[model samples]
Structure formats: structure tokens, C-alpha cells
Target chain A: MTPALAIRNVSHSYGARKALDDVSFSVPPGSFTMLLGLNGAGKSTLFSLVTRLYAARHGEIEIFGHNIMREPGAALRRLGVVFQARTLDLELSVMQNLLYHAALHGVGPIEARRLGQAALARAGLAERAKDKARALSGGQMRRVEIARALLHEPRLLLLDEPTVGLDIKARADLLALVRELVQEKRLGVLWATHLIDEIADDDQVVILHQGRVLATDRAQAIVVAQGAANIGEAFTRVTGVAQEKLSA
Target chain B: MSEIAAPAGFTFRQYLICLSGVVWREGLRFLHQRERFISALVRPLVWLFIFAAGFRQVLGVSIIPPYETYVLYEVYIAPGLMAMIQLFNGMQSSLSMVYDREMGNMRMLLVSPFPRWFLLGSKLLAGVAVSILQVYAFLLIAYFWEIEPPTKWGYLTVLPALALSGLMLGALGMLLSSLIKQLENFAGVMNFVIFPMFFASSALYPLWRVKESSPWLYYVCEVNPFTHAVELIRFAFYEKVAWTSLAIVFAYTSAFLVAAILAYDPARGMLMRRGG
Candidate 1:
């Protein structure tokens, strides 16, 4: 089966500073792929290329076999992305924000209304739909974003460090919420985060560091290959190889 | 589901819905900020009440074609001030674009399955829609001051001119926003741009007056797109079409919009360089 998200030798830069370098990865359908990296490790840059926020200057990105640059309309129709920043119009009500997003995706008003309500209900934000986005807490706001992302019923969902500012419980809740959807809807998810604990044993993992992909394998397989006891040690071991490779 | 569309996956109905959604959101944003409307109205009214009265005798706008008899400075400058409201509204829309880019929702709009040109066009349409409302509100108040159009149907006739001028000015703002890298520096840039464009144009006074003072200044005003905007509205307010001014404004609108769209293209380097 075609991967939900695929990046092949993608490289991007700003001025002379390289953000992503010779990076490649693929996210299989109906699975949760944790894009593990440190801050400024190019995970956000990878996400940017995938979402076409920044064009893939040097490589190809395919969403369900559709090239992002050449066929963005088709590729993006099945893709949803939640950036790390706060995106809700603070003054607009929750429902209005979702409807605004739906329209951008060419979702009709009546259908947008229906899908918006259902998404909000699924997010457990049904009661807050009429309230302004500012009224919700940070965690609640994140949930609303997830709901908005899913409103178009995308087959692939990409979230960039979505739990950055959330509390421990809120982070776990957000993770569990997405994991449940993957199981039920068979949605492919590329969840980019810096936290290691978010990874599970069977989870597919791509360890990115310093604009380069250090390793790509299952979490447990990486641990075994690197001769590490846990994912935290595996991350450290793979990232260490970067310095030697760079100096060469 | 993954079959490559011919780049026109969306139908006309989807395009309409997208356009309506953008305009609706802009309308809601305007309503939520009632102070914005008040401020847009207040700027034009200030000149009409105080500045125009003071300059009534100092600047003589004799009977021009749009005017059959001697007119008050307030009557003469009303169209310019109408243009003024749009000028400010256009700049405000650009400011919001810069703000929205930082807010991060701009990405969501861009990542939509529609063509980039259409999305930018929708945004321009929304800004023009808001500016029209502000212009009408200003006109309603100016009516009390006896600055109504020269003909009975002047109000209805000026709609097209208002939209055209608004698009031109709003497109200019979007272009400026694309050049702007941050919010902190936008105000300084707007002042340098807005005041010069407004004062040097035919907004507050006619080009003939400037020609009498300085030939170079008259040439400056002649080249200023804002002059055509003012002339277009002034003639439309009198229920006549300023064909030359109409052509100039239309040309500027097309140029500014095309430049803004190109500046925003992902393949280009302007906005992405600014991290927008």
C-alpha cells in the first residue's frame, strides 16, 4: 500500500542556514509515526515542507502517492496539519473557527456545519462551541485545533509539537485521543514531538537531529539496533553519530 | 482518492463557498471590533469638519468639470476623504495580513486545496467589502454636512468606483505587507507610505493648486495613483464617469494585485523569507 506521507531526500534552507538536509521518511497508512527530535532539530522544517508552507526546494513529497508540488490540490485534500503555534482566532467562537477552516478546504457551508458539530462533539468541546476561543484553556484550545484538523476527514494528520505547553495529563489525553482515532478510523498520523515518553514500543519512529535523519525504524527495533535499554538511550545513541558523520 | 486532479479539483460552488466564508469571517472580525468602524469614519470626518473649514478660503477649488458652481472645500474634498477611508482600510487589511501570518492561521488558509490566486483574490475581495461599508458610513455622515453627491443617484453610481479604488489600495497594502517582515516596523512604514500617498495626491487638494505652487509637486501628484482614485470617485459622485481616471485605477489595481500575488507565491522568496 502507498504510504500516507512520504518525503524523499528533501532539503530546505533559509539564507545560508540549513533547516533540513537530505531528509527522507515515509508514514504508513493506519499507523502512528512519532517524528522524534530535539528543538531546532528540523522536525518543524520537515513538517513545513510536507504541508507546502515552505516549498520542498530540493526533493519530492508525496501524500498518498500524489506529488505535493505538482499536484498540491489532490495531495492536500487528504492531508491535515496542526502547527505548533496558536492558530485559533481568539475572538471568534469555536464553531466559527472550524467553519472558516472547512471553507478553505472547499467544504460547503451545510456540510461544514454538520462536520464541525460532529468534530467538536468528538473533541468533547460541544458545550464550548458557541464560546470564544479565548475562553478555553491551553489544553482545550489544542483539542479544538485537533477537531478542526479532522473536520475535513483527512486520511493523514500531522501535528507539530501539539503538546508543547500542555500539562502532563493534558499531553497524555491528547495523545490517547489521537491514538484512539487511528485505531477506529485507520487514519495515518505523523506526530512530531520532542518528548520521548510519547513513544510506544511498537510505534514507528524517525529520529531527526540537526537537519538530518539519524535513524528510521520501529521504536523497539531502534532500541535493539543501538544496544540501548529504552528509547531515551536509543535517541541519544543515534544522535551521537551525527557529529562524527558531519566532521567527515 | 489519490488520483491526481487536473489542478481544478474544486467546482464553482466550492469557490463561491470559499469566497463567502472569507468575507463572512472578515465581516465578523469587523463587527467584533466596532472601534474599527468608528475610527475609519472619524479620520475622514476630522478633515471634513475642521481641516476643510480652515482651508476653505486658503485653497480655492474653482468650478471644475465635476462642479458646475463654486464649491466648499468640504464638498470638493469629500471624494478624496472617501478615498482616504479606503486607503486606511487597505493598509489595515495589510496589517491584519502580517498579524495573521504571525498568528499562524494563514498557513491553514494557504494549505487549502484551492489555487493560490483564488485564495488571495478572496482575501482582496473581503478587504474591498469591508472598505465599502466604511465608505458608505462616511458618506452617510457627510450627507448631514451637505456633501451628498452632485446628482440624486450619485450614491448608487459611486459603488463601482469605491470597489475599484478599494481593491487598488488594498492590493497595494497586501504588497507592502509581503515586503514587511515584522509588525513592529509596519507602522513606521505605513506612515512613510500612507501620509505621502495621501498628501501628495489629489485627496486634500487638486493637482492644479500644486502646479501653481510647484511644477515638480504637480508632476508628483499627477503620477500618484491616489490622484486617479480621488478623481474617479469625485466624478462618480457627480454621476459622471472619469474614463481616464477609471482606466488608471483599473490598471493600478491589476498591477498591484498581480505583484502582491507573485510576492506571496511559495515558489518566490518574499513571504517565506519573512517566515510568513
Candidate 2:
């Protein structure tokens, strides 16, 4: 089967400053792919390119087999994204936010309502549907966003630092939710983060450092190949960052 | 991956659904913010009640084509105030856009599977719809104050003109919003674009009066799109049409819309290093 996403020889620059250089990676179906990067490591830049928020001017990005620039409608239909920023309109009810997103994806009112209610219930937010979005906690808001992302039944989900501000318990629950999605729904996930604990030994890893991909393989494979104890050390060895700083 | 990729598009039914959804959301936002509705009406009503009252003695009116005979100063400035509501509304949409960009709501809309032009056009139409409601509300209030149009049909005739003029100003606002990335910088836009566009147009005074004051300002007013918008509304209110003004408003609306579409394009427009 074709990889759910492909970035071929992608390089992006901001005027004289380069943000991403020769970066390429792919996430296979039914796998948790960790995009490991430090702050300003061009992770978000790659996400922007993949989502067509910014055109991949120097290379090509394809979802499944659809080119984003040539067939954005088709590519976007199969892809769902949760950006790093908070997006819910605080003034709108939780259901309104979900319905608004559903409408943008061309979902009809009756069907959107059905899917929205079900999605919110799955997120443990069924009771908050009529409440203002501001009533939800940070973790609840993140869950709402995830529920919104899945409303279209996308084949691939791209999340950028989703657990950044969440508490440890909430973070674990969030990760488990996504992991369950991968296992049960056979969804392709590109989870971008700087956290080392989020990656499992069997999970696919893409180590991006300073705009370059240092390695692309299983977490255990990279750790064993580098003779490191864990993903943090492996990342340090490949990217030349200190082990102490890697986990921090 | 589906093998068939010819740049997919929504069916007409899907397109209509999306359109209604967008308009409905806009209406919801408008309804939730009763202050926005009040402010939209208050701005025009203030001028009609106070500024026009004061100017009634300063400016004498001759029989213009749109005016059957001698008309009150408040009657003469009614269309301008209606267009003012739209102009402010267009800017209001821009303000919302700036805020929405920061809040990430714009990202949700921009990531839609539909075309960008269609999305922006729907937003423009929504803003126009809001402006029309506000205009009619102001007209009802003004009607009680003896600011009625020439004919009862004038009320209906003015609807299309208000829509067209709203589109022109709304497109202008959309173009500005695309260019304005930061909210702090928006204050400068209000001062530089809004005040000048409103005051330099024939909204407050006649072109002959402007020419008498300064010939260059008269020329500026003649070319101002807002002037044409006001003229369009003025003529339509009297059951007549200003063909030249209509064409000019249409052309400017198209130009502004095209520019807005380009400005919002990430690859072609605003490719600032921080964002790209």
C-alpha cells in the first residue's frame, strides 16, 4: 500500500534564512510516526507545507497519491490536521465549532450534527456540546480539536506538539487515544513533538535537526545502530546535541 | 490513495451547503454580538441626527437627478450613511479576520477543500448581508425622522445597490485584511484608509461643493469608489440608475476581489519569512 504521506526533496527558506533543507519522510498506514525535533527544528514548517498552508515551492508533497498543489481538494479530503495553536472560537458553543469545521469540509447539517455529536461523545465531551467552548479545560479543548479533526473520516492525521501544555495525565491519555486510533482505525499518524517519552521502541521515528532529517527508521533500529540506550541518546548522537539537553 | 485525481470539486449541492453554512455562521456571530449591530446602526444614525442637522444650514441643495425637488440635508446624506455602515462593516470584517488569524479560526476556514476564492467570496457575501440588514434598520429609524426615499419602491430598489456597494467596500476590506498581518498595525489602517475614503468621497458633500472648495479634492472624490457606491445608492433610492457609477463600482469590486484573492495566497502573496 502507498504511504499515507510523502515529502520528496522538500526544502523551504524564509528570505535568506532556510527553515527546512532536503527534508523527506513518510508515514505508513496503521503506524505511529514520531517527528522528533527541537524548538525551531522546522517541524512546524514541514507541517505547514504538508497542509498546503504554505506551498512546497522547492519540492513536492503528496497525500496518498494526490499532489497538494495540483489536487488540493482531494489531498485535503483524506487528511486531517491539528496545528500547534489553539483554534476553537471561545464565543461559539462546542457543537457550533464542530459544525463550522464540518461545513468547511462540505459536510451537510444533518450528517454534520450526527458525526459531531458522536465525535464529541467519544472525546467525553457530549455534555459540553451546548456550552461555550471557553468552558472546557485545556485538555478538553485539545480533545475537542481532535474530535473535530476526525469528523471527516480522514485517512491520515497530522498533529503538531499536541501535548505541549497538557498535564502528564492528560498527555498520556491523549497519546493513548491517538494510539488507539492507529490500532483500531488503521490511521496513519504523524505526531510532531520534542518530547522523548512520546516515542516507543517499535514506533517509526523521523529525527529532524536544524532543518535536516538526520535519520528515518524505527526507534529501536536507530538506537541499536547508534549503540545508544534510548531514543534520546540516539537523537543526541545523530543530531550532535548533548544527551542531557535532548531529554530536557 | 484514489487513482483518480483531476482536481476534485464539490457538486452544486455541496457548494450550496457550504455557502449556507458560512452565511449562517456569520449571522450567528452577528446575532450573538448585539453590540456590533447596535454600533453599526448608531454610527450612521449619529450622522443623520447630529452631523446632518448641523450641516443642514451650511449646505444648500439644488435639484439633483436623484432628488425630485428640494430635499433635506438628512435626506441627501442618507445613502452616504448607508454606505458608511458598509464601509465600517467591511473594516469590521477585516478586524475579525486579523483576530481570527491569530486565533487560528482562519486556518480552519482556509484549509477547506473548496476553492479559496469561493470561501472569500462567501465571506464577502455574508458581510454584505449584514450591511444590508443594518442599512434597512437605519432606514426605518430615519423614515420616522422624515428621511423617506422618493418612492416606496425606492426601498426595494436600494437593496441591490446596497449589496453591490457593500461588495465593493467589503472586497476592499478583504484585500486590506490579507495585507495586514498584525492587529497592532490595524489602527493605522483605520486612520489612513477609512477616514480618507469616507471624507474624500461625495458622501458628506456634493461634488460641485467639493470642486468649489478645492478642484483637486473634487477630482479625487470623482474617482473615489466610495463616491460611486454612494451615488449608486442615491440613484437607486429614487428609482433611477447611475449607469456610470454602477459600472465603476462593479469594476472596482472585481479588482479588489481579485487582489484580495492573490494577497491571501501563501505562495504568491505575503510570503513573509516568518510565516513561509
Candidate 3:
């Protein structure tokens, strides 16, 4: 079967500065794919292109065989996105934000409420549904965003550093929920992060640096090839940078 | 990997609902912040009740076409007050856009499934709706002050003109929001674009009145798109149709909207800057 998302030779730039250069990757259905990159490695830029927030200047983005630029609505409908930024309306309650998102996707009130509640429950935010988003903690706000993304039951979920600001416990909890989503719902995921701990051995990993893909394969295989016991060293070996330089 | 189903298409009805949803949210937000609504009304109301009062004696009334014989200074400036509300609201909306961008809500809007143009159009329509409400409220207050047109039909005729003029100004706000780089620079926009656009037009004085003061200023007022917007309202309040003003308002709306869309084009790298 065709992969859930196929990106081909996508290249983008910002006025003499290249954000994404000759970047290409694909995510199979029901697979958890982690996009590993440091800051400014074009991870968010790639997400923008995939979600059709920005058109790819010289490449094609195919969401389940639909070209995003040619058929944006259909392509976007198939993909649910959780941006790195907090998209919640601070004044509105959690339920209101979810309902607004659902309406944007053309879901009616009754079904929207049902789906929204289910998604909130899955994100462990059912009780806080009536609370204002601004009243919630940072981790709770992130969970609300995840719940909003799941309202449409998208076939593919694009998360850009979803756990960026979360505590260790929150991060682990979010990752567990994401793993469950991939297995139970058979949804494809593209999780972008710079942190190596977010990756699992069995998960698919794509290493990006300076807007180019360094390697793409099973996470454990890369670690083994690099003769490293964990993903951090493996990432360093693949990107050919010292640990301190990589940290910087 | 199993094959997943393709997603459904978006409908026109869905578009309308989404537009209404966005506009309603804006209205609700506006209502929640009572200060914004009060100020939206108070700014124009102040000029009408206070500034106009101070200038009434010094500013002599003229027999403009829309007016029958000598009109009161306050009555003559009503259309300008209406335009002023829209002008200020337009700038406020632009400021809100910048704030939204800084606060991350704009990113959420950009990622929506709908076309970007549709999203921006919805926002502009919402601003226009709010401005229309302000104009009506001002008109009601003006009636109690006995400064309104003589007929009720005159009031009815002003609605569409208010909408058209509101839309034109709102589009200008949208364009400025997209083009402005930082929130700090927005203050400069108010001083340079907002004040000049309003004062240079016929908002406070008739074009002929400007001519008596300075011929060049009068010429500038006659050519300004904002002057046409005010003229549209002035004529509509008198139960008369000004097609020339109507056409000019439409033209300004189209130009500003097209420029906003182009500036906001995702691939254009206009909004690619990272926000804190």
C-alpha cells in the first residue's frame, strides 16, 4: 500500500536562507515516525509545508495520494496537526476550543460534542473540559491541543514538538498516549523533536540536519550501526557532530 | 500498513458556518472585554458630543447636497463619526492580529483546513459586523440628541453603506496586519496610516470646506478612497444612492483584499518568522 504520507524532493528557502533543502521522507500507515532534528533544522518548516500552512516552493507533499497544493481541503482533512505553539483561546473554555475546532472541520454540534469528549478523555482532560484554557497548567494546555487534533479522527497526526515544555512525567505520559493512538487507532504519526529520549528503538526515525535528511531507518538499527547503546550517541554519530557541538 | 480512506471535500455551507463561527467568537471575545466595546463606542461618541460641541460655533454650516438648507455641525459630521469608528476599529483589529501572532493563536488559524483567503475573509467580515453595530448604536444615540436625518428610511439606507465602508476599512486593517513585522511598529502604523487616512479624507469636514482652506487638501480629499466611503455613508443617511462612492468602496475593498492575500501567501515567507 502507498504510505500514509509521501514527501518528494521538497525544498524551501527564506530569502537566501534555506530552511528545507532537498528534504524527502515517507511515513507508513500505523507507524510511529520520529523526526529528529535540532533547532533550525527545518523540522517546524517541514511541518508547515505538510500541513499546507506554507506551500512547498519546489516540491510536492502527498497526503494519502492527494497533493496538498492541488487539493488542500481533502489533504488537510486526512491529517490532524498539533502545532508547537499553543493554539487555544485563553478566554474560552477547553470544551469551547474543541467545539470550535470541530466546527471548522464541519462536524455538527452533537457529534462534535461526542467526539470532543472522547478525545479529551483519551488525553486525560475530560474533567477540565469546562475550565478556561488559560487556567490550566502548561501540560494540561498541551493535552487540550492533542485532544483538539484528535476530534476529527484523522488518519495521520502531525505533532511538532508536542512535549517541548512538559515535565518529565508529562512527557512520558504524552508519549504513552501517542503510542496507544498509533496502535489502537492505526494512525500514522510524524512526531518532531530534538530530544533523543523521545524516540523508541522499534520506532522509525528520520535524522535531519541543516535542512537535509542525514539518515532514515529503524531507530535501534541506527543505534547499533553507530555502536552506541542509546539514541543520543547514535544521532551524534549519524550527524557527524561532537556531543557538545550537537548540544549547542 | 492497511489502506486508509481518503477524506471528504469541504462544502460551501461548511464555509459559511466556519465564517460565522469565527465571527461569533470574535464578537464573544469583544463582548467579554467590555472595555473594548465601550471604547469602540466612546471614542466616536466623545468626538460627536464633545469635540463637535466645541467646534460648532467656529465651524459654520454649509448647504451641502445631502443637507437641506443649513445643517448643524454635529449633523454634518455624523458620517465622519461613523467612518471614524470604522477607522479606529480597523486599526484595533490589526493590533489584535499582531497580538494573536505573538501569542500563537494565529498559527492555529493558519493551520486550519480551509483556504487562507477564506479564513482572512471571515475575519474581515467579523470586523465589519462589529463596526456596523457601533454605527447603529451611534445613530441611536444621535437620534436622542436630535441630530439624525429626518426620515427612518434614511436610517435603513445607511446599513448597506456602513457594511461596504466597514469592509473596505477592515480590508486595510487585514493588509496592515499581514505586512507589519512587529507589534512595536504598530504604533507607527497608527500615527502614519490611521490618522493620515482619516484626517486627510472628508471625515471631519466636507471637501468644499477643505477647498476654502486649501485647494490641494480639497483635491486630496476628493481622490481619497476613504472620502468616498464617508460620502457613501453621508448620501445613504439622506436616503440617496451614490454609485460613484459605491464603486470606489468596492474598488478599495478589492485592492486591499488582494494585497492582503498576496502578503499572507504561505510560500511568500512573510509570516515565517518565529515568535517568542
Each candidate structure's TM-score, on Cα atoms with residue i matched to residue i, is: 0.96, 0.96, 0.95
In candidate 1, the second chain superimposes onto the true chain B with a TM-score of 0.95
> Taking the candidates in order, what DockQ does each have?
0.62, 0.64, 0.47
Top-DockQ structure, candidate number: 2
TM-score of structure candidate 1: 0.96
What order do you get sorting by lDDT, best first?
2, 1, 3
Q: What is the per-residue lDDT of model 2 for residues A52-71, given as tens digits with 9 covering 90 to 100? A: 77888988898887888888
lDDT of 3 by residue, B39-100 (tens): 88888889889999999999887797877789888988889989889888887888888888
Clashing pairs in 2: none
Pairs that collide, model 3: none
Per-residue alpha-carbon lDDT of candidate 1 for residues B186-276, written as tens digits (9 for 90 to 100): 7776679889999999888778878999999999898899999999999998899999999999999999999999987888848668555
Fnat computed for model 1: 0.69
- Model 2 chain A scores worst on lDDT over the 10 consecutive residues at A239-248
Ranking by TM-score: 2, 1, 3
The interface RMSD values of the models, given in order, are 2.0, 2.3, 3.2
Which residue pairs in model 1 clash with each other? none
Point out where model 1 deviates above 4 Å: A241-248, B1-8
Residue-level lDDT tens digits of model 2 in B1-276: 333443367888888888888888899899999999999999999999999999899899888777778888998899899999999999999889878878877878888888888988988898889889999999999999988886699999999999999999999998988778788867888799889999999888889888998999999999999999999999999899999999999999999999998887767867344472
Ranking by DockQ: 2, 1, 3
